[model samples]
Target: MDVKRIVLLISLALVSYLMVLQWNQDYHSPAPSVATSAPAPSVTTASSNAVEDERLHLGEAPTPAAQAASPQALIQVTTDVLDLRINPRGGDITYAALLQHKQRANTPDQPFVLLQQDNQRTYIVQSALEGLANRGRIQFQASQSQYQLQEGQDSLQLDLAATIDGIPVVKRFVFQRDSYEVKVSYLLDNTSAQALETRFIGLIKRDNSVDPSQGEALGMSAFLGAAFSSEENHYEKLEFDELRERRYLSEVQGGWVAMIQHYFVSAWIPDAQQTNLYSTRTDNQGRNIIGFKGAAQRIEAGQQAEISANLYLGPKIQSRLEAAAPYLELTVDFGWLWFIAQPLFWLLDLLHDFLGNWGWAIIVLTLLIKLAFFQLSATAYRSMANMRKVGPKLQQLKEQYGDDRQKMSQAMMELYRKEKINPMGGCLPILVQMPVFIALYWMLMESVELRHAPFMLWIDDLSMKDPYFVLPILMGASMFVQQLLNPTPPDPMQAKIMKMLPIIFTFFFLWFPSGLVLYWVVNNVLSIAQQWVITRQIEQQGTS
Candidate 1:
């Protein structure tokens, strides 16, 4: 393959894989098919007294269960400041491993057994939940007073008293809004004096879906017991009765990570050990799919053991994820070329600053890149140029050694030696830049910023193919011109196949994002212009 064609193939394959990984992780939708999706309000508490600076502290956010919603099928519930998420139908979630709790609004009443699903991406704004649910209490006295959301406070601390066994169990859950970290503090006011043993497991879970038979949709992981039926490729919207969704895992064992459709996920840990966790699901029948039942946990008496965890529910921005945890971000699963995918994003961000528009940014960036490699390209061109210059003599040698492969091979090497031409002059630059070019292509496909971004006239979205295919046609034309200028190989069949490369690439580029095509077009044009200059210089040198 010619240098350009090889780069194009690598770029296409890598881009496709990147998109698939994001689709599975729900990190991004390829072309921004949904436009009205609003930027979510700050999921944080007001800490910076400055009105303009939206500062939120760790102790000021809400839990994950206080909101309700459906994105056409997207489940989002906002109570006070709580943002709750429901896993889509056929998605993976369990009932037992969920953090389910209910609470009343007034006077610091504690929460009850509010249900929780698995890997759901919902959030709870403490104040919002208090106001919206109005007292999410069950068989308990729950009410709220002295609720004031100051515009610039870091956290809203409140006292909670739950009457479990005819005794008031007082605890404090510090809800930090901005950072989404809820700190739970328990005041062991048991007065037993001897010692009291208890377990304090923090709760967070996905919501149940309309469908109950075959839980949330494709690519989600769920386990069925020995008697349970297999659920595969059976999730369809708008069912006659109700949709089946994974309720909650009864227990989570070893390691656990919940997957939400194109949203967010979390891995639950128990004291950072290899202990087993049980799981279950709540069907419409509310039949529990308990994968693990009666799991064991221990708590010491008299002294206090507290639990804390960090929840990440924003867009699955890779850098933010990396900051959150390692191997945590790799859950997105970019293909074998992830090395290229990572750096491509870095390069795109840098180029975007210079060009302003990401589409134009890609174009200018590719052009500059092509120019930077002009020395190598010039070398490649010079190889072809010198080859063409010796064409007449080469043909005369072939004619003399007709039908003899050894004679032609010897004659060819002799000619190259006499002319001091390197047979593989263009190889190094082509191989060196191949990874970078492919990675950039994948970045354009993977980045959320490029979704719905527009190029010049008639081209609206840079992350999608040009609507009219104008850019692809022009890209093909440029490649064809460059191909015409390339050194013609001796074999006629090889020459024919090379001649068809431009057309093949044009079709391939047609389905790619516009930013990618823009890169190719600019590179091809530069190559053509450079070829003209190099060929002209070679002609002059030969004549001299």
Candidate 2:
């Protein structure tokens, strides 16, 4: 491929990826739930003779003005310990509540005095779904931090005991309380050792009262394709075209590794990982709803089945994640990523480390990549130029073959055979570059570092659209000019339609991020220049 051809290809691919990036942001998932349906207890018992509204306030006191309030109908759960931040926009929990998490002053999603709940709450939200993230939280039956260690060593004994039914169930969640991954060593030691029989089960339940219609901006939808349609533009309620979702699970040494990115929550699970405290939702309208209940099995006395797993909770970064295991990075599938997608994410990670900025890193990497592929691109341009020069000959052949499509194909093949031109020679470089393009798409999409990241003028945020529409306009202009430079078969009707491609492409890219447009614009400019030079060189060679 020649430099010009590479530039053109890069431009086109960049434009396509930009569309992908935009799609990821469209469906915004809210944060994880707080507790089951409970709100934090209040410090003061506000009794204004408030309409016998005493039931209106359940916790210790009422919701403080400075604190983000939980829904009025807060019900205290007696399950697992969880802390959550109540977000204002959708009345959803923006952050998760963890073990011993009594009160939080401030969090990533919200900054305010978090509402506190004690034992149980009488106040319930419109539905339990929207109130899952806050105060009157639940507690896991078994806890590791509560476990006492041996005589004089930090090496703690796996001490766990709980009652599932009339039968006493004892098992240790062998993991650090704060960590996402752990090993759950289950020992159904029939203390009686009298061959007691009972069913072993692992289950998490959601509040049945949750109302899905109470929330908005559910999850990413139709990001896989539908954006190209003329009918897709009018719909705002649907997922914006660039949203992405990925779930990666793998078998590792002792247990398994998982990489998960849902709308509101992102998690990475590592091998030998276990957790007794897990939060789940059962609302019909929640985006990316998940529920798992392991099959019930009868346990033999004094026997054990070791279950291990590694879990990660956060953004999709390659280095931080792949360090967890192999192929875990695939959770950030850009768009039909192939072999090189993982490598591309790694490269982006390397660039991010050096440059300390993902947006700039992507730009630098793209530039270097363009330079590296200079030779292939140059050849592609040269080939295209030759074809452009032979336009008259190919046209003549078409006319000569007239109504005989088979003869035209044969004549074209004969001409290529005589000229030593491989009919598919130009496709190789393009095909080879597809993975890199796909990887880059996810690189931008999954990189939380690029979220709200700003570039130079007219592009305040690499993750968002160009506020002035200047970049998109330039993008369309570039596409149009590049299309002009590339030679097409002689057909007046086809040429006219091709001319409309820029306008069409421009409309799709209007809401796309500026960094993507910049890449396309640069690539297009380079392609135009390369095509011009190659065309000139071919003409000179022909004359000689």
Candidate 3:
């Protein structure tokens, strides 16, 4: 083996492997296929015992057996961007689907369901008063079973009314025409002789199911679990397993808690001006829960007070997320290279705005990156060409110093110096660019903008693997040609391994997203072109 080449290969492999392992840990198993027909929402809530232990300051009593057993009515609400079901029992959001995003690229009519409570998965949002004893079991009544935004309407509000301990309370869910943030508020009519004191608690409870929005691809997976922002920390994440091991608790002013999966996220943004308590715990049914409770509010007799919070349920679109809450956009994770990835994504998004196509945007972004690093790449290619020019001389030196490692090393170093070539010149420049490449990989993997995007013929969804396997093949062919332009290793074993790299990489990329594979194919082709021209010039100079 060539010591330098072997070491470089091992180093690259180690870095890539570590990155993949980290990404795998961030994700769970592949999500079960979306059901053809939606199932009824499950009637579930956090256990009373678990809530008492957490000391959420929810001074509530046990749920009445009769109320808990009764079949709760589900109120359906439809807006321009949202279609969701509200359970009148706790007035929880039992199911939600994004009307704009489809469950599958081919199924244009079926909207992508974000929160559902059925046999396969259990993810729902709950909001209730902290002081009321029957908060979780209140059978609120709605004026209608279904509500839809009018043709010219810009917003819609659905109210579920119930009396808790003789205090008339109304839970209202407010939805806007083109917004994903739903305002959930409690209207307290304190008509009794005494004052009504209560705090608003909003939470999201979900089971350990894989991210249904994630595509089945041989690529880095997105992070799935609970994330929140606090006064001490801008953003923090805990995996389901980690949440199970220990409880997470924090107190901050104006923070939000969220359940994140792949491209979509559901978060509860509490009152920003007042301090709130945030926590995470598992429910009786093993569902992970993250929630926050606002500061206590006292409603004097014959007074009306409204306590409200925002529930954002939709894609991780940066603009929407930033508007939803501070640090909420961090949920669109791009790994440790976010600094580079964010800029790259910004440029890609800008290009997409002009081109109106993600595939073309990616190609243009790759070209831009190549242009930015043109000088560095040229230097690297020039070094490789010089190495090719001295290949014959290096082979003669190896043969002359056979079985004498020290002399062979000295002879190769002398030849390289005499030729004014740096043996590591090509590799160092490429190594300097690895962080950018890895950052781009993460950016492409995590961006929902490219989810169902299409390129030219044979590629329908940029987020899905290429059905024809054409891009990977082209990528492999380009890699082979690029290798041909470089100096071949003198050792037979090393040379054979190098020859197999393209084949191995092709198989590895077979299941990658077409958008990602397209980028690779383009990059490889460009590199080959640059290396070939430089190699031909060096060869001509040698002959002359």
- Per-residue lDDT of candidate 3, residues 1-544 (tens digit): 2546866686559555844643454454544332222222221223333344343533343332321222346788999999988877778787899998989889999999999887678898887787673344567899999999989999998988888778888888889989999999999999899887878888788888887887677387578899989766888988887776677766668989999999999999998998777777665455677888788899999999999999999999998999999899999999999999999999999999999999999999999999888889999999989998999898898889998988888888888889999878887788888899889988998998888888999898998888989998998898898888888887777788779878977876777889999999988888887778888888899999
Lowest lDDT sum, 10 consecutive residues, model 1, at 226-235
lDDT, candidate 1, residue 126? 16
Q: Which candidate tops lDDT?
A: 3
Cα lDDT, model 1, residue 489: 63
* Local accuracy of candidate 2 as per-residue lDDT tens digits, 1-544: 1333455456666656555444443444333333322332221212233212212111222242322344432222111223333222212223343332212212334321112222221111110111111322211243322233233442333434443323344333333333323233334444344344322122111222222211121111212111110111211111211111221111112222221322111232323222111112222222222211121234455554333233343334554445654544444445456355556666767887898765677677777677777777777777667667667887898788887767877887788677666544455665666566556655555454454556666565665566787877887898787766666745555567568768977776666656666666666777678778877887898899
Ranking by lDDT: 3, 1, 2
> Least lDDT summed over 10 consecutive residues: which range in candidate 2?
225-234
Model with the higher lDDT, candidate 2 or 3 = 3
Candidate 1, 1-544: lDDT as tens digits: 2443455456546545644543443322223121122232221112233222121121222233432223343333222333433222211111111122112112133322123433532122111111111223212111342233356766655445454333344444344445323344444444344444433233233332321211111122211111111122111111111212322222222332333222233333233232323333222232222221112223334444343333343333566555554344554433357786776566667878877888777777777678678788788888878877887887788788988878887888889899997666644556677776656655555464564566778776665567788888999899888767766666556568668777877765666667777878888888889988998899899899
Best to worst by TM-score, what's the order?
3, 1, 2
Worst 10 residues of 3 by lDDT: 35-44
Q: Which numbered prediction scores highest in TM-score against the true structure?
A: 3
Considering only N, C-alpha and C atoms within 3 Å, which residue pairs clash in candidate 3?
Answer: none
Per-prediction TM-score = 0.57, 0.53, 0.91
Candidate 3 ranges beyond 4 A from true positions: 1-3, 14-72, 133-136
lDDT of 2 at 61: 28
